[model samples]
Target: MKKVFCIGELLIDFVAEKQGSDLSKATYFTKKAGGAPANVACAIAKLGGRSVFIGSVGDDPFGTFLLDVLRENRVDVSLAQRTETFTTLAFVSLAENGERDFVFSRGADKELQYNSAIKSEFAGNLIHLGAATALLGGKLEEAYGHYFFDGLTKKSFISFDPNYRADLWKNKQQNFAKKCMTFVEKADLCKFSLEEAQLLSGKEDVAEACRFLHEVGTNIIAVTLGASGTLISTREFQETVPSIKVKAVDTTGAGDAFIGCLLQQIAALTNTDSLAGDRDLLVSMVAKANKAGAITTTNYGAIESLPDQEQLSA
Candidate 1:
């Protein structure tokens, strides 16, 4: 399999136990290694893929713990950097149905500097850009833009996920959508949540949303529809791949798991350029990715919930 370079934030998520979507009321909390790209890296590594995590964390214990978790899951963290800034953190409060409310403490995650050497090494590999904190504006965002353009020039298979967090954007949803379009317009594969698809594409219908996104430039689009499964689309065809039934404990990282598994399968392909025309293969990959997502919902913490190849097969 080709190497998958997952570039983004790596943070500590403080999840409040049984808290009903109100961070103000949450008392008890547990820390877990989390971040959209970090979770994707772990998901790919856990499934026996060559996964590398590239991002910055604080030179603190929290950062140490996060790196340790990635190493334990077999995710290559050699490119992960440490900075003097404090590690980023998100305080999450879960509702009864597993939905969550989040409050963020931005920190070292925004400090990832662009490396020319790293950009040069991305040639002919797979690159996943799925950071929630990336667009918040800083060195990370600059690095993200540099890596994306460099990947394009190097013939890397680029996948993008606009990991939207309403809490972080506040009243700037329009601005967020605009920033995301830049990536959506160039990515080989784009993954979006139902909400992200609607917000970014300005279409309520899933098919219409896919059309809008494809017209912008993405060759492949996957819109994750919670329990309804994922809507996989290409210019020629679009279909909803079914997900396995499971009582969701927490929805966090489910989408990451889905896209991670999908990318892992894509990385193993000899020619990703033909992926858009191969409907049967696309459907097969999405079906397996759905299983990975469903399995993630059966447990709590993001990285901890990811299933291995043996578990995926069973």
Candidate 2:
């Protein structure tokens, strides 16, 4: 199988299961290995796919835990960097029905920057961007180019997940929408939550939003809709795949797992790059991905609850 190169943040998530969303009245936060890209890498590894993660973490207990989780799941961490900065932390609030809200305390994840190694590793790999940290500026934005746009464009296929979080962009740049569209245009396959697709395309209709994205240059667009299922569209055909119902638990990392599962099949398949003409194959891939995502809600934590190949095959 070809390797999937995941770029972005790795953080420690502090989760709390409460009777209600009112964290002010209730109590307790459970620490877990979180962060979207990190969870995606773990999901890939657990499904018997190869994934390598590149990012920076602090020299702290949280970082140690994050690294241990990734290594335990069989992810290659050679490109991960360590510094003295404090590790990033997210406080997750989950409701009884499995819906979630987050309070993030950005730390070392913001410090991940460009390096020559990203270019060297880009060839023949499927690159995934988005994990809360990739949108940060400074050397990191430049690094995105060295790897995705410039260095490896000719050799590898690109996949993107905007994973937009409204909370993080409040104090940032004036051109946030512009930056997102720029990256969307470069991806071969891209997935976004319905909320993210609207935010990026400025179109409320999911299909219209996806159409705009494709017109702008994204080849394959998949928009996730919680339990209702996923909307998959290529330049050829579009379909909505209904999700397999499951007992709900934690909503965290479900979308990331969906992306991971999709990439797992793509990287393992020889015709992955030619997804446009293979409508039937594409539909099946998205349907399988939808199942992987729905199953994630049946468990807790991102990495801890990811379904393995045996469970998936069964």
Worst 10 residues of 2 by lDDT: 17-26
Top lDDT model: 1
* lDDT per residue as tens, model 1, 234-304: 99999999999999989889999999999999989988889999999999999999999999988888999
Give the Å error, residue 188, model 2. Answer: 0.3
RMSD values, in order shown: 0.8, 1.7
Tens digits of per-residue lDDT, candidate 2, 1-314, equal: 98988888899888888545555544888889888888899999999999999888899988998998899999999988887889988888888888777778878877776776467567777888873657667555666656677424556788888777766787553356778887787788889899888888889999999999999898999999988999999888789988899988888989998999999999998856678778888889988988889888888787888999888877
Q: lDDT at 155 for candidate 1?
A: 91
Alpha-carbon TM-score of each model against the true structure: 0.99, 0.95
Candidate 2 Cα RMSD (Å): 1.7
Name the TM-score of candidate 2.
0.95
Query: Residue 235 lDDT in model 1?
Result: 97
